[model samples]
Target chain A: GAGVSQTPSNKVTEKGKYVELRCDPISGHTALYWYRQSLGQGPEFLIYFQGTGAADDSGLPNDRFFAVRPEGSVSTLKIQRTERGDSAVYLCASSPLPGTDTQYFGPGTRLTVL
Target chain B: QQQVKQSPQSLIVQKGGIPIINCAYENTAFDYFPWYQQFPGKGPALLIAIRPDVSEKKEGRFTISFNKSAKQFSLHIMDSQPGDSATYFCAASNYGQNFVFGPGTRLSVLP
Candidate 1:
């Protein structure tokens, strides 16, 4: 009965360092998504995975941003050579199907590049 | 260009009053309209959602009014309670695409 969960609730790292945010989707959830939320604005989609393969990754800002949902249960959003501008709340969500299904979100991991 | 535009970045309402948040989208491809509520330190939760096929949909004190021709939709909270005070976000997306969220409205209900 556990909902979606994310680890490393808050992470502060130096610029150019690498960081990985983890997400654990609900049981039997086949679709996972990643989003980034900037202050005073809305969440911007980063990537989404259907099972093991990423179905939609066009939202990823650049090549440095990547994600993997191997085993179709847990996902990790990895950022390489983090920039100060990459500081934001990274959110993860899951749904039963690909589209039209209500997504369940996790508490999110706040990544700060200090 | 922003796909979804929401108005009144913030709102204050009385406990028994109705707080309406409106949103407009430029992409006609959007078919599913969903509203999410978020607390200060938590993730967003699905509040209510609507499709373009229906003019209006109501669930309890929450109502969603859709205008297909106008490419707009609004969420109306009737007799809002203080517990409802939080950030409300309106999102638009197709059946199998990424959602575009609005800037969000910070609702403060005074009891």
Candidate 2:
């Protein structure tokens, strides 16, 4: 693709429902990342994947939040038992090699949990 | 703890004026500093970037002033315009690591 792509630009789900958001990164990019942004706040890092392995998942808030990159090209973020507090914009970004290279971000998925 | 801190949750600037956004970081290991601009319903895009070795870098109307000793950096927009109104984020990163972003500052340029 020309740029990173995210699925379900907007999602509305009731509390306790399970939701999955997908991200397709640029072709052959070695690194991919996920972030969450709340109203009036900066994007918070959620997790980062280097190739087929998750190099850093320290930013994952809790057990309820999980992400995976099986083939090193596409990734998925899963939220279990979503709560109202989980409502926020989920962003996905990709970089060539996860170093000094710039990251291209997707349009983001705005999840509204009520 | 937040690795980077930004100031002025919101800023209002008049047309033709210069708007400056400041950021400070505690991590000395960060060598790459970049600023991103984001519009409503859009993802953040790289506006400019600077390396630790350079004290300042300018690209047209945008300039980045870096103070390596103070662990601080700032973005200056010259001749601000209404179209420039958006949210700006400052971020820092070390080699092969995740970029840490500041809280972000909203800039509104009134025509």
Candidate 3:
């Protein structure tokens, strides 16, 4: 794809249900990131991946939240036992290199937990 | 602690006026500062960026002002237009670190 792409533009689920959000990064991008944005707030870092390894997962709120970049090109963010507080927009971004300053963002998936 | 802090949660300006949004950072290791603009439903797009070595950088109607000493930076929109009404975010990052974003400022350009 010419740009990053996210699946399920909008997802509405009930509390305690499990959900998965997928991201397809730009071709050949070696770095991928996941962020969450609440209403009226900026995106907050959730995790980062370098190749197939998670270089940094410190930002994940808890064990219920996990992300995997299986082949280093596409990634998936999984949430278990979702709560109402989990409602927010999930953003995916990618860069050519790990330390690159610029990251191209996808349209983002708006997740609503009722 | 919020690594990056932005002020004036919201700002309203006339179409032809200039709108300034300020941000301050606590980490001195940050080397790159970038501003992003986002409309209601779209993802943020990079507007302009500045490095610590340069005090200022301008691109078209958008300019970034950097203050290394005070650990502050600001975005100045020149000749603001109604189309420019959007939420602006200031972000900072050092090598190998995740980009940290400020709270963000919502700007409204009144025509």
Candidate 4:
């Protein structure tokens, strides 16, 4: 039984560059979520998907931030025109269907925009 | 505006002592409350959770006291150990989006 996993543990890029962070959720979990954590702060909601479709994307800061879970199992968060303000730890979480409100989290990818 | 507010940004407690971290939310619609524990470089792990119907829920040494009337909740760790030192976050459910989390509390339990 593997837990959620994220790729590119640490990524450093210049401003205006594009970066993609991937996440693999637990097997059989039908719901996935993305969050961002800034220094000394709580994780902020980004988006969440139920199955292959995003149920909510309101938390996404702007059009430059987008995510997809085309297969309902793996997801990728895409950021365009990265800004120093976007630098943070990107977190992925998943939960079982019928909604228990408990989400299992991955180690996260730290994005640094220089 | 932040939906949830948590306090004592950080705390230090001696082994065998109890440490309490409190959180308050402005949104009354929040239905579920859960606490997460995270060590450096590690992902957050669910510790304990409570629903609005109940005033208190205890599992092991961790306890969650919910005050629906006050729109607040508190996490209490009993007989804490040095191993318990970590950052703790309290979160409230936001319908389908998972949650709105409070600013985390960093706990350092000294042995």
CA lDDT of each candidate?
A: 0.91, 0.92, 0.94, 0.93
For each candidate, report what fraction of the true interface contacts it reproduces: 0.70, 0.63, 0.67, 0.65
- In candidate 1, stretches whose alpha carbon ends up further than 4 angstroms from where it belongs are none
| TM-score of each predicted structure versus truth | 0.97, 0.96, 0.97, 0.97
Top-down lDDT ranking: 3, 4, 2, 1
Better of 1 and 3 by lDDT: 3
lDDT of 4 by residue, A1-114 (tens): 999999999999999999999999999999999999998999999999999999989899999999999989999999999999999999999998846688999999999999
Among the numbered candidates, top DockQ falls to 3
Return the clash pairs for model 2, or none: none
Q: Report the CAPRI category for model 3.
A: medium
Q: By summed lDDT, which 10 consecutive residues of candidate 3 chain B come out lowest?
A: B92-101
Q: Per-residue lDDT of B1-111 in model 1, one digit per residue for the tens?
A: 447999789999999999999999998878899999998768889998998999999999999999999898999999999999999999987774687899899999999
For candidate 2, lDDT tens digit of each residue in B1-111? Answer: 348999878999999999999999998878799899999999899999999999999998999999998889999999999999999999987774677899999999999
Question: Model 4: how far is A18 from its true place, Å?
Answer: 0.6
Local error of candidate 4 at residue B89 (angstroms): 0.4
State in Å the error of residue A62, model 4.
0.7
Q: Measured against the native two-chain assembly using Cα atoms, what DockQ does each of the candidate structures obtain, in the order listed?
A: 0.73, 0.70, 0.74, 0.70
Tens-digit lDDT string for candidate 2 (A47-87):
98999899889889999999989988999999999999999
